[model samples]
Target chain A: MTMLEVLDVSGLVTFQDSGRRGWQSYGVPLSGPMDWFAHRAANSMLNNSTDAVVIEIGLGEAMFRAKRDCVLAVTGTGFEVVNYIWTFPLWTSFYVRAGWRVQVKKISGGNWAYLGVAGGFEAQSMLGSKSTYLRGGLGSAIRAGDILEAGKPARELAKLTARNFPVEKFMNYSQSPVIEVIAGPQQDRFTEEGVQTFYGSEYTLSKSFDRMGYRLELLPSPSSAKGIAQATSADLLSEGMTLGSIQVPDNGQPIVMMADSPATGGYPKIANVIRADLPLLAQCEAGVSKIQFREIMLEEAQENFQKLNKAFKTPKG
Target chain B: MLKPLGDSALLVQLGDEINPALNQRVHALNALLQNPIHGILETVPAYSTLLIHYDPLTLTFDQAAHWVRDKMTQLDDSFHRTPRRLEVPVRYGNASGPDLETVAVSKGISPADVIRIHSEREYTVYMMGFTPGFPYMGTLDERLIMPRIATPRTLVKAGTVAIAASQTGIYPLDSPGGWHLIGWTPLKLFDPTSETPFLFSPGDVVKFIPLESLESNSLLFDQ
Candidate 1:
């Protein structure tokens, strides 16, 4: 089934899936959806395979026109969805009539939104994934006036009607989230006070944020302006870095490594935000979203991660 | 020390500095577990650490840590396998290398002396990072060591052979890089179509051979 012609794209829209895996050893980053839960949720609502390629839209407004009638689901945090003058709620499947226009506008509370067709968007898959890595010139790049083709939907538009998922059950983006984290590999490199401050202090997501990292700033305060101090000033021997790894460089603020973070880094990591709260951190509006960090034990973090996976589990009928 | 990284992977830290001994142990552990444990997914070996990605659903953090810790105890420290030796051909000076004169002038050496100093040493592929298939080779001759340029160029063409403090590397793909560009290589470091995409692997020994002219390997750039 072929549909969805891109009309206008003010934001960066690219095709993404579960990400390219098993290539990190060669210095390749696992480029995928910034909001892992939202991507899977959109696909599940349409009974699409969990690994289906969805369009990741970031930076604000975009417009798409359907070439033919198709079943579509849009999920993310606080994005307004409209077909003509009629608005539609997110996290639910909707039938788009042929030649109708769909407009997605960012109202507030998030930086990314996912558009998953029932059959999933067909895109250029390189190195075992359709996830777009623009820097590496790897996957599909969607621009204004491009034609998007998709595979056959498991069921026609009629069967996907009325299927809706409550986003609040999995994530509540409205509130300033108290994100959970675990100790990182270089946790010992931070001062005792630094560890305490990282967990206690409120941080604002800086504008210097991207798929590589989300640099966090110590929320301005009367006394705690120096930020998280370090035990050592030396950079660590460059080593493998993982997603959510919170590296506190010489400046003392933290940079949360994200989906497209390099395979390795040299900065001293203070702590790592748990996998469960990464989506929440990724969605935070840069410079606008206030964030807090709460340290959790490894077992607790494991349970939290599993809970998120369960919510995003696939093959829905 | 085996430490948990968030809830997805474990960081096996072998040492605190960049040394061949530490890199050997890193690659040793990687070789031992070429076929990963039941729940482990992939292993990424770096200068002094190895990151093992795992499935959180199948293996709990403790279970994965326990399995790797057992292997660490039995890790072979002795250098058993002979490293692979390969030569990378480079076109130095002139249009192929825009910064050759500046680099030579900065180091108070002729361009030929700089090339001779850079290509003589057989550097070890310490790790692959910065970009895909971009090897972080080390033991750069002290005479040629230069810190990265203050202002990085917006577009450093792919296959640009460059150097930074104590290291020499190739730009596998066109990227914005700050490294001091000393030469250019017709060889593609990253070939996604090949059986082995990356030209250099950790634990391999690489030597750079300067290309006096390109007529010898015109077919290389064709691919």
Candidate 2:
């Protein structure tokens, strides 16, 4: 069995897979990579299955030594991979010979980055997931002196030249960054002015953002609604929450729930980020990233979703 | 009452307000849905609503909504029968409960009186959320109602007993919290290593016993 020794790890580094599903019934939030598209892309680059465990690096540097020759790729924002002491940016694939040391440097832009080994890193699974939930003390983030096992029996790599995968034709932060949305069940609960403001005005990404939710600072709205508030007074019953659900609590500010959000919340959701644009939201950088919402038909949303999935399924040569 | 929550989920609401009967109904439906039901991916119980999450691939939104309605209609006298009662022990009014005096003053009652009233009444476990193992028990004695602090403390130690909005509960982990601390409990409400991670499930009844009683009898707190 091949293993990688962690020479250094950042404070926020952890192991993430597609996430532990079917456990929300026990009050566990779905803990996984904040950016699913990047996670899958990193896995795909190595020809690993979509759900293979990958290292989720955040805001710090990790130095490791490969015990075996393996193909690897880095995806998501910020951070760069230094192989043989050379820096490679996001979405590129490379091969590292056995015994070569690789270092992931501090994030330069985004909050998270993913490093996927050709044969996925193996770790103890809890509740059928390799992902770590820091809040619950399930799995700790990767640390120095920690050893990680690689998945399964290794196979010989076919003699092949490294090639760049063409960027897919889909929405990302770098592309048409607007997020499409649908009118929510509680959209009517907001004052008519609030609704107009929501669509017409732009919001900046607040500094306070994480896997739980993203708080968007509301711009001064000329048509701001005065007192349109959440209808249900009681704390909402716990229920299935998902990525892109826009929750508005009593404070009048809206929070876009992300992957790790609880199964339920008391805040009334004003809209859901269209499925196609959720990936874009995942890749967005903090700061004054302008946000505007446009309503689209459910059928159109589904079509866009299918298109994105199809692009993801297409193999890169 | 039920409403369309979204294309993929439906909200089966009991009422606009939190009522014990409604909470029990939500829990009953949750238990009923747990046995590998078709099309239902997840059923989550909240303070006043039960959100049924279904797979859009297996069942259409309308079909899932209809299924939930059908299940609710089939529920009868047997569903609302006696719930499991759990006795929890708490050590009140020390570092465990930093806000005990504050809460007592806010309610115009003595700290000792607050403890007596809180311990005497049995509360319902309305839902489990806000954090893992954080039980949202409700129907607290009206005398204990207190507003959440205007400025929420950034950190509240785990097992810190707290009260807010006519409800009483325990913090499962040390996280940023706002609930008024009344006391602390030594029992671990949520341990991921345990076969059953959650100490209290929805529809369960919870009674708080004084820590003095547990110490005197040398009795272990068991659910």
Candidate 3:
């Protein structure tokens, strides 16, 4: 087996896969990579399982040296890759020879990035996942001087160099995104005018956002409701809440659920972001980014979901 | 009435209010749905709703909805036996419970009286969430009702007991929280290494015993 030792690490970096499922009943949130689509794409390129453990880096650089020759792919917005004195853009698959030092510079585009090695990284799987949950203290992030073992033996020099690893074509990370949503269990909780405003006005992403939820600042409603007494906050019976459910607390600001969100919540959910758009929202750049929701029918949402699933199931060369 | 929470989940709601009857119904339905039933992946019981999450591929939304609706009709006929009860000991007030005075003042009672009232009642574990091992025990004595802190504390010690809005829970791990602290327990509510991580499951009965009983029991067990 080949191994990679971390010389230095920056920001919050952790080993994540598709996430641990079937444990929500135990009150464990499904904590995994924020961008599932990008993670899957990187895995597809390597012909590995989508749930393979990869290093999820957020805002910082790291230096790693391969003990044996290996094939790996780096996917995200952009991670600066330094090969000797040469620096190159990330998000593409490349081969690293044994004993070669690979350094990632500061993040260029997205807040989080994924680095997938062929055959995946090996770690202790708690509840069948190597994903780290910082809130539950389940798994800690990768740190300096940590040695990680790769699953399979490294390829020979000639075989490794001959392998062609290219980046997969995907949506642009820098574009302004529109997330589609379906009206929710509590859409009626908000005033009719408030509902109209929610779909009509553009809200800005707030600084107080995290893996738990993204808080959006309220924008002026074009058809604002006046003099309607705030509905008494109901003592909701906690229920199973999923990622992308938009919860509107008493302040009327919406908080979009994320991968690490709690299993249940008391706040009323006005809408749920469609499955196809959740990945786009996960890769959204922070700070004052406007969000507009377009109402989508359930049938249409399911159709899009099936299409994405079909795309994911197709064998990639 | 149950509503489709999303394409993958359905929320079966009993009532808007948190009545004891509604809670019992939720728990009963949760137990029935625990078995490997068709189209059901997991059944999560809460204060008044039971959320059933299923895979859309195996079970269509319409089929799952109909199955749940059929189950709801049988809820009234089913009989529930008394649940197993566990007595949990606690060291109340002082450092363990910083909000003891505040809770007492709001209830117009002495701190000692507050402890008496809390210990006298047996609570039901409504659900386990918010944090792992943080059991949402419900039906707290009306006098114990208190609002959560204006600003949540950055860190609350593990085993720190707290109460808020007719509910009581113990902090399973040291994490940021806002519930009014009332006591501490030595017993670990959650251990990830255990086959069953959580000590108490939904619908289990919980009674609070004093620290003196805990010490006496420990000595007896040692002998």
Candidate 4:
């Protein structure tokens, strides 16, 4: 069996697939990679399927050593990585000599990164997901001294070696982008001014951002009299929540729910960041990542999401 | 009413409040749509709303809305199906129940009376959320209803029986909560290794049986 030994790890690192599906009724959360685009890119570089298992490296830094000759890809923001003696780059796959170390070093920009080895990481599947959901006690995080295993590569090691994925073809993380939203299910709970305050203002991604949700603090407008986005209703009845739900509590700071958010919540959701923009939002570094919101129709959101899926059909050079 | 939740899901509001009648309707609708409807990926039934998850490429929001509407027409609003009833054994009013005396005092009753009133009537499983298998059982006798403590405890232990507002809940895992602690159960509500991890589903029925003292049920852990 193909394998890699975890030599060192900092922060939280876990194996995630395309999330657990079809189990919300029993109160199970949909746990998966924080950044889907980067996770998939790491998989695509090695000709693996979109849902193939990959390592999600979160927070400070992590390091791993290949126990056997294999192929691997690294993607995501914030950290500079060192693959063996080479000054490595992100978004590309390369062959690994047995016993070489691929160290994820320096958090200069983002929070999470993906390391997709040849084939996929093999972990005990719980409820049909290889994803590690710490809250549910499902799968565990990868730790130092732990031996991680993977299935043999799908193709010849020679053919899978050195596959390059261009950064320009993907959602570029360099620019400060306008994340789009469709009005949330509980939009009626807020006044027109409340909706405006959400759409017309800049918000900073606060430190509370995680796989559960990205908490956004509304920046004060230039004119103080514009007013805050307070909900007309005091306490909302708890209801089912979707991925990317922008729930505003009493403080009026919007918390955009992510892949592992609870199935149900009580806060009045003003809007939902469209599915097409979740990956971009997920890649944003806490405190450092500044974002703005744009309201778009549901049809347009759906179209943009389809376009994104289509673009990932093949990464451009 | 059909509400849009991003590009992937639709929230179907069947009723306005958290009434049992409303919840039954939600569960009925939940049962109908759960049987492998084309494009409908999953149905999450809450207190008064049913959330439908779908594949965007196969079904648009409008298409899912239309399909749900079509399914609604066929649902029996008076739907009453036999539910799985579970009896949970709990040890009340000691170290297990930190707020048992306070709850009884607030209601002008003795701690034992509080236990009797709580264990008397069976409650309905309104929803399962906040954690795995933490059944949100409700309709506590109005006489027993008490406000949740002002400050939520940072960490409540697993299998703790707690009461807040009008619902009774069991802590399946160690989670931060605000409910008044009244007892604890040895039986695990979330047994991960079992084929059925959760002890209750959304539409199930549950009753709490008072235990005199702690009993060893160590087989329920470290699976």
lDDT of 3 by residue, B75-192 (tens): 8845574787998878888888899999999889999998999999999887889887788887899899988889999999999889998899999999899999999888888877
lDDT of 1 by residue, B110-195 (tens): 99999999998898888998889898988898898888899999998898998999998999998989998888887878877667
The DockQ of each candidate is 0.78, 0.38, 0.58, 0.74
Worst 10 residues of 1 chain A by lDDT: A308-317
Best by DockQ: 1
Name model 1 segments beyond 4 Å from true.
Answer: A312-317, B193-195, B213-223
Check candidate 3 and list the clashing pairs: none
Which has the higher DockQ value, candidate number 2 or candidate number 4?
4
Model 2 Cα lDDT, one tens digit per residue, A60-174: 6788887777777787766778877577766777777778888887654466778887778887788778888877777887889887788752344432115344445453554
Runs off by more than 4 Å, candidate 4: A223-228, A314-317, B213-223
Off by over 4 Å in 3: A78-82, A85-91, A106-108, A153-174, A219-235, B37-39, B217-223
lDDT of 3 by residue, A16-130 (tens): 9888777776688888888776687667656678788888877567889988777766767656678789664465567777898888776545666777787788877877678
Candidate 3 versus truth, CA RMSD in Å, comes to 3.3
Question: What is residue B206's positional error in candidate 2, in angstroms?
Answer: 0.7
Candidate 2 per-residue lDDT over residues B76-120, each given as its tens digit: 657655789998889888677888899888889999999999899
Computed on alpha carbons, the lDDT of every model, listed in order, comes to 0.85, 0.74, 0.76, 0.83
Question: How do all models score by TM-score?
Answer: 0.95, 0.88, 0.90, 0.95
Where model 2 places Cα greater than 4 Å from the true spot, the runs are: A9-11, A78-80, A85-89, A105-110, A153-155, A159-167, A219-240, A311-317, B1-8, B37-39, B76-78, B220-223
Candidate 4 local lDDT, B114-159, one digit each (tens): 9999998988898888997888888899988988889999999998
Candidate 4 has what TM-score?
0.95
* Clash pairs for candidate 4: A78-A109, A78-A110, A184-A271
lDDT of 4 by residue, A78-182 (tens): 877797677678877888889998898866667788999878888888888889999989988889989888887778878887777776664767436699889
